[model samples]
Target: MTRLRLLDATRHGALHLDRARGGARRRLVPLGRGEIAFAAADMPLCFAKDAQTGRFELVALLALAGENNLFTSPAGYHATYQPRAAGLGALRLDPAGADGLAVDEADASLGGAGDALFTDGSAARWQAELRAVVDDVVAGRALAEVYARRGLLRPLRITLTMVEGDGQVLDGLYVVADAALAELPDADIVAMHRADELAPAAILTASLAQVERLRQLHNARYPQQIATIGLAVAD
Candidate 1:
C-alpha cells in the first residue's frame, strides 16, 4: 500500500495539478471540518474506514452505488459548495503524510501541462490553500477518532430505491450515533462541546438527511434516476 508521502519540492517539483475532465469519477471524497459546516448541507457526509490505514475519516458521498461522482461533472465540481480537499486535485489528504499531505506522483495530470506544483524551488502559490485544507482534515480526524473510542459511531447501511426497483445496498459505512450521545452524561457532552468535538459529531448524523438530495442529484444527472435511499442503522 502507498503510505503517506509528504510533498518535497526537489522530489516532485515537476508535478502539476489537472482539474479538467479528470477525477470526475471520484466517488468518495475526503471531507474535512474546514468545509463541514457547508458540506454537511450539500452532500451526504459519513465516515468510512480507509483501506490502507483501517481508520475512519469523514467523507462526502458523491454517489451511492456507482463509481461516477454525481456532484462533479466532466468539467469540474458542479456544486456551489465544494469540499476543501477537492481543490487539491491529485494531492488528497493522507494521514500518513507529514502534515496530512500527500501527492499522487502518478496522477495523469502531473506532467506539467496544468498548474505547476512547484515554482522557483519553493512550493507554488496554491499550496498555502492545500496546507490549510490538510490542517483542517488533520484536526477534524482527531475529533472523529473520539467518536470511535467513545461509542459515538455506528455502522451505516443504506438501500437504494430507484426507477429500476431494488437498487444497490451500500454497507460498511459509519455515522455518529445520536442515541449514544444522548446517553452520555452531561459532563462528557459539555467537555466535547468545549473541545469543539460535539458539533461535528452531530453534523455527521444530521448530514444523513442529504441522502434524499443524493437521490435527487442522481436523478437529475442520470437517464434513470432514483426515487429514494432507505437508511438503516446497526448499533
Candidate 2:
C-alpha cells in the first residue's frame, strides 16, 4: 500500500507536484481567481519517500475550483459567497518576476511560517469547521475573538444545501464576500461571509453537482451561466 504524502503551498498558485517524469503534475488546478491564484503557485511541496519505489509522491491538501463554480438547483439558486478580486485586506502574493506578480521559487522569504497551513489528514474536517465558524461570524458574532481563539487563515468548503430563500428553498451553498452584502433574512439560512474584502472568497473550493433529480428538468440551459465568484484556500 502507498502511504499518503502531504504537501503544503509555499506560495499560492495551482497545487502541483514535481513528478518523477521530469515534469510537474498538477494536484489541485487553480480556477484563475485573483487572490488564491498567486498564493497557491509554484511552492516547494513536501512528501515522504516510498520505500519500494524510492521516490516521493506529493499530493496537495486542497482541491481545485470547478469551471464557473456552478451546481444544480431545483427550487432555483439561492445566494452563496461570490468570488471577487482581492481588495485591501487580501493576502498578498509574492512577486512572480523580478518585478512582476510571479513568485520566485528560490526565495527564502517565501513560505514564511508553515504553521498557517493544515496537513492533509485534517484538511477536510477543518474546511467544514471553518464554514461553521463563518456562520457564527455572520450572525452578529465577533470575528476578532473567534479568530483569536481559532486562529485566522480559515479554510472554507463550498457546499450545496436545501434551505428557504424568499419563500423558496434552494439547494446550494450561498455566501457573500461580506456579511453586509447579504440581503436574505438571518433566520432563513446560515450566511457565510468574509470579514475583509481582501480575504480570499472561499477556501478549498469545490463545485456543486448538477441537479439530476427529475428528468423533466434536465434541460440544456439549466445551469445558467458561469458566475465570477472568487475562491481562496481550496481543498
Candidate 3:
C-alpha cells in the first residue's frame, strides 16, 4: 500500500513508490500570502496505478469551494467530492454515504475521518457482497429474474437506504439487470422492502436477490439485532 504524503504546495514535490513515482513540479501561483496554487503545467505528471490490480496507488487531494474537497487519482480520476453542510454530513459520492457512516456536519477538521471508512474496508465489503448476491440470483434461487426485468438490479439504480427508528418507508432504488419478469406481486415487494430491517440503520438494495444476501450477511454480522426483525423471502 502506498501511503499518501501531503507535499508542500510551494516547492516541487515528488512521490517515489516501489513501481512508480509521481509529483507536482508546477510553478506556484500565489493565491494569498499563506496559500498558493500549483499549476498543473509545472507539475511532474504521474500515471495512476490500476485500482483493480495494483497494490500501490496514489491520489491527490484538492481543496474545493466552501471548505469542500475533492479526492482524485494522480491521473485525474475523480474518486470522491465532499462539501460541508449543517445537519447533513458532507455530501458523498453516493446518497447512502451519510447514513451508516458517521459524518461531521459542523466540523471541517473532521473531513477525512469518515472518508477512510468508505475507502478502507466498507467499499470492498460492499462490492464483495454485491457480487455474491448477483451470483446467488443467477443461480435461480430468488426473484432475480423478475428484478432484472423491472430495472431493479441495475448498478446505477441500486442504492443504500437508511431506516430510522422502527419506521418503514417505501422508496424506489435503481438497479441493473436483464429485463425479464416485470409482473411482480405486491407481497413480494413488501418482503423485499422489509429486508431493510436488518440494522434499522441502512440497507443496500440492487435486486430481490441482493436483499436476501444483505439479510443473510446482516444476520451473520449482527445476530442480536437480526433477532429483532423478521425478513421474509418471496416464494
Candidate 4:
C-alpha cells in the first residue's frame, strides 16, 4: 500500500519534504496558480512553506493501493493495477446497514465557493501538530498530549485521495475532533471499526500509536460521514 500527502506551499511559493525513514529530501520546483506538492507513504514526508509566496491553504490527500498486491514483480504488479469506478451507491446509502451502518460523501474540494473560511486555516499549524504526533509515535510515547492540544469541540478535516483496488479514485475528507490510543478503546470503537473494516489487519495491528490516536479523534469529532482511511505510521 502507498500513502500520498499534499502540502500547501502556495503561501510561500515553495515547499520542502524530508523522508523520515529513507532520508530522501525534496525541494519544490515552481508552481502555477493551482498547483501543490505530493509525498508518498514509504517516505514520512514533512513540508514547510517558503516565505516568499502569498498566503494560501495547503491540502493533503493520503492514497493507498489495496493490500496484498497479487504480482510479485513491481513491474508486473503495477501493470496489473488499474483505476476502477468506486460505486458511489455504496457511499450514498442512508444511515442503515446490517449493523446500523450509514455512509455519506466527504467534501473534497480545497476551497470552492462556500469554503473560504475553512480554506483560510493554516496548513503550517496542522503540519506542525502532525509532526509532533509522528515524533511521539517514533519514540513509543503516548498521544495524550497531542490529543489534548487539539480543540475539544472543533472538528479537524483530514483529506484523503484513494485509488481503489479497481482503480477508481475515492476522495475522502476526515474531520477529527478528539483522539485516544488503542489501549483506550472506549474512547473510539466506531473509529476502530472504520480502521479495521477498510484497512488490512496487519496494517491496523502494526500501526503506530499516533495513527490510532488520529482515528480516535476522527471518530469522536467527525459530525458526518464515515472515515475509511488510516495513516501508515513509519518508524
Which residue runs of candidate 2 sit more than 4 Å off their true CA positions?
Answer: 1-67, 71-82, 86-92, 96-98, 103-220, 223-235
What are the per-residue Cα lDDT tens digits for candidate 3 across 39-62? 121111111223475321111112
List per-prediction Cα lDDT, in the order shown: 0.74, 0.25, 0.25, 0.24
Q: What TM-score should be assigned to candidate 1?
A: 0.79
- The residue ranges of model 4 lying beyond 4 angstroms of the native Cα positions read 1-6, 9-122, 141-235
Query: What's the alpha carbon RMSD for model 4?
Result: 21.0
Residue lDDT tens for model 2, 1-235: 1222222244343322111111111222112222232332322111222358543222112212222212123333222221111010012122332111232233222243222323542233333433443343233123222222322222334332212211222211222223332433454223333334223333312121112211112223334322222223322
In the order shown, the candidates' Cα RMSDs to the true structure are 4.2, 18.2, 21.2, 21.0
Worst 10 residues of 1 by lDDT: 92-101
Sum up the clashes in candidate 3: 14
Clash statistics: count for each candidate:
0, 29, 14, 8
Error of 1 at 188 (Å): 0.9
Worst 10 residues of 3 by lDDT: 27-36
Candidate 3 deviant stretches above 4 angstroms: 1-167, 174-207, 227-235
Instruction: Report the candidate with higher TM-score, 2 versus 4.
Output: 2
